[model samples]
Target: MPYQVLARKWRPQTLQDMVGQEPIRRILSNALEQHRIHHAYLFTGTRGVGKTTLARILAKCLNCETGITATPCGTCSTCQAIDAGKFLDLFEIDAASRTKVEDTRELLENVPYPPVQGRYKIYLIDEVHMLSNHSFNALLKTLEEPPQHVKFLLATTEPKRLPITILSRCLQFHLKPIPLELISDHLHYICKQEQVTADKTALNYLSKAANGSLRDAMSLLDQAIAYGQGSIKSDDIHAMLGTIAQQNLFPLMKALAAQDSNQVFHAIHLLAEHTPDFSNVLEELISLFHQIAVSQVITYQQKTDQQITELAALFKPEDVQLYYQIALLGRRDLAYTPSPQQGFEMTMLRMLALQPKQMVVQVETPTLTVAESPSWQEILPKLDLSGMAYALAANCTLEKIEDHKVILQLSANHQPMLNTKLKDRLRESLSNYFKQAMQLDIIITAAELYTPAKKQEQEQVERLTDATKAATQHPKIKQLIEMYDATIEVSLL
Candidate 1:
């Protein structure tokens, strides 16, 4: 016997053996146990997510010699025949090749007849959405009122293309993409069973590359086993996939965070030697920035490397956001560039050049005159703060300034936004702005106090009022109003 690929060899024979679709599995199992089987069932999802496989399992459950069951006995001839794709009653049709109305009519002609060897004649149509409009119309009547002896199992990647009439008659189950961790774990289990040596990191790389498809992961695993000569390794997987190691991306991120032009180019030069897919490199960078941003804003629970945590602390949240957006655009525009490497290099350079420069505050403290004492609103813009730190500062009113301390009064409503990190950032910004080290002391107060945000809101309202008044007074506007009998929309103005 020829050796079968991992995907086929590991094909789930029972519903319980299927992985990563617990909700669908539970629903199908209950329906089977209750014997509340639908005449026509539609399974819709992306490729390799087990739409067709689930359909086959359902067929076996209905036709098994032991009788209809949620757990069909694999040894029974009916179950064995269905699993081997030799069952006479299970008509597995690839609708992509036979999409004409004639083909649909020909298939439905047998629907009225009783099963030759099984309990029910099952019609499993894969990629059913590929059927033409006329074909769907031709199948609509039969699909809506199929014989008691017939069952229709339809699977498609795109269900929206299916007519409402056809969709309405069938019980649709949307299979979700398998999660990465599930795929990784399944691959690890398979490797152990196959007696193949494999690294966890290699499986993880394959999992990510599979993009939620277990079949794709298994196929990639088969290729990886051959590529590594039976021992799966991370470096071999990366090379096979045209991607760089995760650690290789760290140096580039570090260089970007430091905003060192020479280091950035040097990192890129070293990365290019690996002949990686530049688009994938950009995607990795974007993912890293996103993780960093999440780490900065929240108590990120996802397991991250120590370097990522350090980089998260080293880079500001706003900078991470900016870099993420730039990397996104860079990836999109990569194809139009002269070369992938050039496009990637330009994207990295753009990130480095556009990063906000650190303000060089003089260390010496200067005495300020009474006239030179600036208001909080005046100082807010110059602080160059962003994210929650900016919001915290904007919502607080300056209470007083002591020798080494700055007191702020935060409205009780906005007190929830206050945190130790924001307070430290605010303090550092103030110290920089005043050219002296200062500590922040925030007091939550219910007393009404003017803040920069409120001041700015008032100023905007005044400007809008002035603009509306000016627009209403314009001669052209008066003529148009008189002719059209229209009132001025102050908000629009």
Candidate 2:
């Protein structure tokens, strides 16, 4: 037998063998078991997501010699014929090539006839959206009211181009892109069955490159196997796909975290030597920033790499967010640059230039006795807080400190900020500031209290009133006001 590619060799024969697409698989299985088959079915999704492949499986299920079943026996002649693409009843049409109204009419002419071989005459149209408007108009009537012996299976990557009349008449199933982990696992399983030596990291890289398409992943695996001479390695896969190793990105991230310009350029110089796809490098950096931000915000049960943990601890949450946005913009603008490496270098430089400089200050820790407890307003600025935690702290007034518990009264208006995460963060910040373990009790009160936020508001109002009064009394202002018949507006001031 001639050499068959991995994608063709591993083509799923039964519905159960199909990877991913659990929902659609389940639905089709139930429909088959119940014998509630529809006349026309439409499968829509991106390329290589098993749209046409699913249609073929459905055809087999309907035409199998063992009778209609979700689990078709691949050995039966009918199943074998369908699999071999020699089934008389299965009319596989590529709408891209035969898209004229005449071609459509000619095809629909056979719909009224009964099956010559299989139980039902199945029409599997691939790239059905490529059919012209006139062709779709010709297919509409026959599609809506096909014979009991006929089943229409239409698959398309672009379903929007399909007319609503055609879409409404058919039972549509949108197949989602296969997830990365699922694709990777499927590749691993295939490697085991094929007796091929492969690295797990290499499979992961291929899976990401596939972007949720199992067929594409399999094709890439075939190329990878050939490239590695029957074995797969991560470095070989990286070279094949023009992607860099995950470790290559860590050095740049570490440099950025440390704000070391020389080290940043050095890291970039080393990375450029690999001649990586800089756009992909930017994407990797963006992904790393996102991971770091997630790590900073939440505790993870999974064991993270020591480098990621260290980077997360070194960089602030806000800094991660800023870097993520900058990397995203950099990736988007990479194509317009003179060269990809220059674009990548500029993006790194931009991150350093725009990042807020951290100021180091040394202050002696003051011991506070219960009798000498500081005002809540004074403590608010000292606590390490940002985002919702800072907002929650600013709107709270210290009630009392009993033992290690710090009681706070929160304004009822800002009650929405009192989630467990924010509350725990506030408690942690307070504990850190006081140089001792502390517990927090926040009571929401509708009654107004002098919170730090309210105090600041009052001081701002007083200053504005003083400024307006001073402006109204000024000689130049009074003369201009009288000349223009204008009254002083504090808001304008």
Candidate 3:
């Protein structure tokens, strides 16, 4: 016999075998027992989450020889035929493959008739959202008012694309991704069944990579089994998945935490030789920072006398936030840069540069100065526009200005789509620079969209931003960010 792949071999043969979808199972099983069946059912979920599989199981339950029983005896001819995909009453349609008005009409043509063998004719349409708008409308009528003998099972990753009228007519159940622990248990079970030897550490990595997909995790495990040739190792899994092991990531972190750029750069060059994924490195680094943050909090809760004192000295919250931002922006820019090494070096340098400059170690903590919130004057300069454009942006109705103090009234309604937090942040930035006092009051009220007189003006703004970005390399500008930091975002408006 030919060897079957894990995904196919481990496919849930019955509803009881399916994992991570207890609510749907209970509902469907009870519906079968009570005979309270709906004419149309919709199953929606991400890929590898068993939406289609559940649909198939439901079809079997509906058309079994034992007469609509939830648990169909596999020995029965009706259940056997359905399992083999040869059941006359069951028609599985890939809406993606046959997505046309004519195809939908043709399929529905047989729907009006009674089932040839079973009690009901089941139409399972997978990826139903892929159907064209016209095909969806064509099927909507039948699904909304189908013949009593017919049942429609529509499965899709995206249900929003389907018209509300179509959605309202069906009973929708969303299948969730299987949990990691569940996938891990299933993999161990499958390995035992297949007589395959595996390591727990290898399985843990595979579990995370699967991202809550049983089929994907099983497939990975299957590949590992073949690669291991009867033995599984975490090292093999790491190489297969392009992951840098914890040992590799930890040293890189020490270099970063110590702000040792020379060692960090050397390590990066070594990493580049192996073509280490800078994106993943950045991700792992951020995760480590988060771990450190948690550790810092845990250190604080120590009822011991030295605990709270030590926690206060843990990596300052401000510095942790800075490194996170640096790593995040580094990851985003890594995609556009010429090479990963350059992006890696730049991110490290950014953190080092942000280290607080020496301040003569004042004997007493500096008096806390009350800095006013940001105001329009301070913000206009950062807008990256000049002359006329800058003036127009600053004039954002300079409602009031007195001796370095200013009140700029915004057309609150002008850009209703502007994020509320973003608007307030920008407002505070402007107020801080515009005043020597406490804060510049920002009152946002609905305003209308500003109709630019010339379309070219908006075009010029976009062109200017592109030109500015081209002139300023991300890392170079990143160099200027430090303890008190704010990122510049260019808006087309």
Alpha carbon lDDT of each predicted model? 0.88, 0.87, 0.73
TM-score of candidate 1 versus the correct structure, residues matched by position: 0.73
In model 1, where do residues sit more than 4 Å from their true spots? 300-304, 357-493
Candidate 2 lDDT over 269-308, as tens digits, reads 9988888889988888888888888778777477777777
Model 1 clashing residue pairs (backbone): none
In model 2, state the lDDT of residue 336: 98
Question: TM-score of predicted model 2?
Answer: 0.73
TM-score of each: 0.73, 0.73, 0.69
Compose the digit string of candidate 1's lDDT tens values, residues 1-493: 9989999999998899999889999999999999999999999999899998999999999999888899999999899899888999999999999999999999888888899999999999999999988889888988877889999999999999999999999999999999999999999999999999999999999999999999999999999999999999999998899888877988888888888889999999999988899998888888888878877877847776677788898898878877888798899889999999999999988888767443222222222222222478788899989999998898998889899989999989998999898898999989999899998899999987688788767766766676667767777667646643547655521
The worst-scoring run of ten residues by lDDT in candidate 3 lies at 358-367
Model 3: per-residue Cα lDDT over 1-493, one tens digit each:
9998888877786789898899999999999999999999999988888998889888889888888877877778888898889999999999989988899889888888889989899999999988888888889888878889999999999998888888999999998888888888878788888888888877887887898887789889888998888778887877777666555665566676677888777777766655657776677677666666666667455453343233335457667777877788888788887877678788888887776443221122223333333444454666455444443354354456565444545465434434555545554555565444433433444553222212235556656566446434555444544423645444432
For model 3, state the Cα shift of residue 116 in Å. Answer: 0.8
- Model 2 / residue 185 / CA error / Å: 1.0
The CA root-mean-square deviation of candidate 2, after full C-alpha superposition on the true structure, stands at 17.2
Clashes of each: 0, 0, 11
